[model samples]
Target: MTSDTLAPAKPAVDLEGITKRFPGVVANHDIRITVAAGTVHAIVGENGAGKSTLMKILYGMQKPDEGTIKVNGEEVSFRTPSDAIDVGIGMVHQHFMLADNFTVLENIVLGAEPKKGANLDTGAARARITELGESHGLRVDPDRLVEELGVGDRQRVEILKVLYRGARILILDEPTAVLVPQEVDELFDNLRELKADGLTVIFISHKLDEVLNIADEITVIRRGTTVTSVPRSAVTDARQLAEMMVGSELPTPETRESTVTDRVMLDVKGLTLSGGDGGRPLLSDVTFPVHAGEVVGIAGVEGNGQSELIEAIMGMRALNGGAIHLGEEDITSWATLKRREAGIGYIPEDRHRQGLLLQASLWENRVLGHQTRPPASKGIWINRKASRADTERIVKEYDVRTPSVETLALALSGGNQQKLIVGREMSGEPVFLIAAHPTRGVDVGAQAAIWDHLRNARAAGLAVLLISADLDELIGLSDTLYVILRGRLVARLDPSDVTPDRLGGYMTGAITEET
Candidate 1:
């Protein structure tokens, strides 16, 4: 063989000495990583450790202050996401971007539509999308509306959307954050297929178990810098990787103590809501009582009335028939604001929609749920000084990583934003808390801290209604667990008596009460 034939090939991606800085936070500092061609490269880090910032730089959402990025051994600079797309780099964000009114094909070929004399060439787009989906293990109906798809199906559409845009490299941020166990397995299988087809994937996630299971190589980042990069085979267990990222072994969500009291804090009786679908109700005959010092968990697949149930309890949605009470006060006729004042804390599933104002500063967001009361307000007047001081307290108590209380909500990482929301909701000593996916995108370290807070709150006689997609979390922290399927309670499981797989079966309706 010739000497030239024996030379090694160039890496698919090489980021060297990359540095990024904000006003007071060093988002990234001298970061370095190299990914081999056609391999699955995983990035693991804590919430505010600068994982998102590095990915933003890679995807051209932000530019680095120093260092270089090389693709296939050739140096390149990206001024915008469009410039990054031109070089075959596509990014799938944790929060998906798609129009609910658009069909699958329309969303897939939206910005880059092929035209047939001033009209959209949808036929060609549909054919290409179908082919890409089938070949990549991501089959979906192109004619289906985006609103009709489930969470997993929606994720598949997102992956397919990037694949159809001629991307050779894909960056997925927290892709499995909302998926159930089976859906996660399916997503991993699809990723394996993509890797087999000679496409490179850069995965960013805080799930160490999933990272170890899927990644060919894993890079750990801590405090805005790369700690180490090692092959999956070289590592023995998730503990090593967890320690590398957070300087500790993975924290369990398990709660063994029983802090339940006899006092009923939140009572929902015969809760019913019309879905506007002929005769079907969105939430049907849901009756439950949460006691003081107890954690009652609701588990179900996405879009199976979990969100609607929360809305009903929080008085955001008008119930066709139901009665809600907080410690025997019939709040069935109360408004959302009235419920808030009645000591019902809410941690919404979609933080951006119901939690915080992204454009507002941290101190301003502190007044979101508790506005018009005490620290956030003073006798129907806004208390900016009190808000700022209390925001500082929450930032310190909740370990929210931020440069200043004046920082905008959009400037923090998803996990930090979640932490801030958690702190805000737990304030004012609310008697009842409705926590929906509280740790959805948070890292393991932050998740542990949040769990600790929940435990402490429960011990202090707080009643909680916890709704989550994570089976382990539900089974671990719940004193009482109820399975919801098609807007009805299917089973009430003992958290300590069930496994994640078994809990998942009930959540997905595969295991019924009859079975």
Candidate 2:
């Protein structure tokens, strides 16, 4: 055997004493981690715990103030992401960076297209992508537009993009945040195949169960430092990992006995929304009633008009034909601000896009949805004192880890941003709330806290429409569950008895209404 084949496996990456400092945030301090080659190393931490910062340092997006980075047993310093890529490191961000107008093959080969005498080598690129997809179990059409693909396909294309760039090590940030149960399983399968092919994978997520499932080693970062790194065999369950990250008991997402009442708080009747440019209807006769103190859950694969439904209810979308009733008053003709004024609260799906202005201060974002109401505004004037005070209250009550209320929303972690959104939407004591993926990117602790808040609100006679991709959360927190497929309600399931698999079957159209 050759000397290279005979030697022991080298550590794919070694980060020692990684310290990165922002103005008010010590993002990472004395962080250390090691990933064995050809193994899946999972990193877990609370929001604002500095996990993302450490990953950025490793991926060369941010330079560490004081640290040593070693790749493949050789010391290296990366001044830019291209430098990291040159040494076989690639990163896939939580938010996709693909162009919607481009095809999959075009996106994969955008920056590093193979050359043929000053011309792009399209055939070679397609062949290589096809080969990679076949080997990695990430099959997708090369000619399909990114906008025309599903969430899972987009994720697969992202993985392929990394592999096509000759990267042997992959860094995935919150890869499964938007995937349904089945899609997560498929992604895990692809990851395992990649591991089998001797590629190193760095997986960062707040989902401990998934970490335990796929990780060969688990590293926990707490409060800007590495708390512990252990083999998968060392930890038994998610509770152990959760406690290590939060220094407290892991909170469960189960709700109490039915707080549901007979009074209908918000009622939708024959809601229909036409697609832009005379396409098919986005929402077709979607009707449901959320009673006071009841939590009505909506479950569906993404891009199936859930956003349209929420927008219609929030008055952001103009409905073709429908009547929305809030406690016996037809509000379909009301404007968006009027809906907000009438006690209808909304927590949108994309926090960065629809929830908060990232460039604004936390207290400023607190004044967003309630800009016209108390503690935020007073007769054409912004009430800064009351707004700042209430923002601080939310920071304390919701356990948002930040230095001060004046900090910009962009500086906070995704989970912290999500926490702020939940706190803002739950404020103003709205009689009805629309919570879409309330705990999407939060850690177990934060997720539990949000669930507790929602449960408390439900008990206080606030009607809620809960939407989520986490099946356990959807099934556990919802008293009544409705599945929307292709803009229509396909199944009304009993959450008490349905399993994730069965619900996923309904979501993917594998199970018909008759079945």
Candidate 3:
């Protein structure tokens, strides 16, 4: 054998002394990462720890202020995403980007459609998509509309979209953030297939367990720098990895003592809503009550009317039938603003859509829902000083990692944004809080802090309706739990008695109330 055959091959991706800086923050500094060819390389970090920034530099979304990037042992500079793509790199963002009205094939071949004369050669594109799907175990029908596909299938389409562009290396940013347990398993399977086919995957995630389970090598980044990079064998457990990422022990959501009270604070009776195509009701006869100093968690698969139930309670959606009462007063007829003023706090699931104005500063966002109230406003005149001061307080209290209160909401990391929202809602002295996926994309540290806040609020006699896809969070934080399936409250589970596996079965409709 030759000397070259005996030596190991170079990494698919190598970054040396990479540094990135913003106005008042050093996003990354002297970061080094190496991904062995055809292996799953996981990047684990807390929110605002520069994981995404490094990935952006790698994918050409942002250029590093210093250092070098090497692809397959060859130095390269990527000025744009297209430049990275040209060097066989592709990135799947945390959010799925697809035209809702377009077909799968159309979406896949959108910017790079094959041309035959003046017309688009969709047939050739479809054939290639089919071949890619079969070869990579990413099976999907090209004729299906993007809107009609499920989340897992949509993710597959995204992977196929990049594969169609001839990418040898893939960067997945929080790919399983929105997927359920089963869907996540399937996604891992798909990833394994990609790895088997000699494609390198750079995975970035806050979920340490998933990272440990799927990754060949794990890189821990903290405070805008790489802490350590180790093979899977070097790390013993997710707890160790989390501690490395956060530089401390992991926090748990488990409540010590039951703070649930007998006084019912929020009451919903016979809640019903019309479904799509006028078939089944979206929320059917959903009746539940959250007592003062209690967290009533709703556990269900995503899209099984969790959003509708929260919206109905918030008065954002009109109910066909049902009575909602806060304390003793009927609030079913109230508008969204009225509900807000009535001490019903809302932390929306999609933060960007219902929570904050990206263009506005953090202080401005703090005054959003509480605009007409005292502190944020005085008789319709904005209290800018009060808002700014209060925002600074929230930033300090909630541990929102930001340079200043004047920073734009868009500048903060997802977890920090979530923390700010949590602080804002809790600051309003709400009688009943509808916290929907409050810690969805937050890091473990932030999640623990948010849980601590919720626990503290519960101790102080706050009623909460917690909706989350994380089974552990629901089981740990909730005093009482209800399982919703196909828009109905299918099972009332005791949080102490249920396991995540059992909960998963109920969420997927595999296990019924009778069982």
Q: Which structure is stronger by TM-score: 1 or 3?
A: 1
Candidate 3 local lDDT, 1-515, one digit each (tens): 98977978889999999999998999999999889999999998888998888988999999999999999999999899999999999999878999879999999998999999999998899899999999999999999998778678999999999999999999999998777778888999999999999999999887788998899999988999989999999999888988888877777789879998999999999999998687888999999999999999998877688999988998889999989999999999988888899899999999999999999999999998899797899887999999999999999999999999999998898889999999999999999999998998888889989999999999999999999877888999999999988789999999999998888788878889941
User: Clash number for model 1?
Assistant: 0
Per-residue lDDT of model 1, residues 1-515, tens digit only: 99878979789899999999998889999999999989999999999889899988888999999999998899989899888888889999988898889999988898999889999988899899999998999999999999889889999999988888888899999999888898899999999999999999999987889999999999999999999999999889888888888988899998988999999999999999988967668899999999999999999888889999999998889999979999979999899998998899999999999899999999999999788799988887999999999999999999999989999999998899999999999987899999999999898889999999999999999999999988889989999999988889889888989988888888777888831
- For candidate 3, give the lDDT: 0.91
Residue-wise C-alpha lDDT for candidate 2, range 416-445, written one tens digit per residue: 999988898888779999999999878888
Candidate 2, residue 413: the lDDT equals 91
lDDT of each structure?
0.92, 0.91, 0.91
Clashes of each: 0, 0, 0
Off by over 4 Å in 1: 1-4, 277-279
> In model 2, which residue pairs have backbone atoms overlapping below 3 Å?
none
Query: How far in Å is the alpha carbon of 239 misplaced in model 1?
Result: 1.5
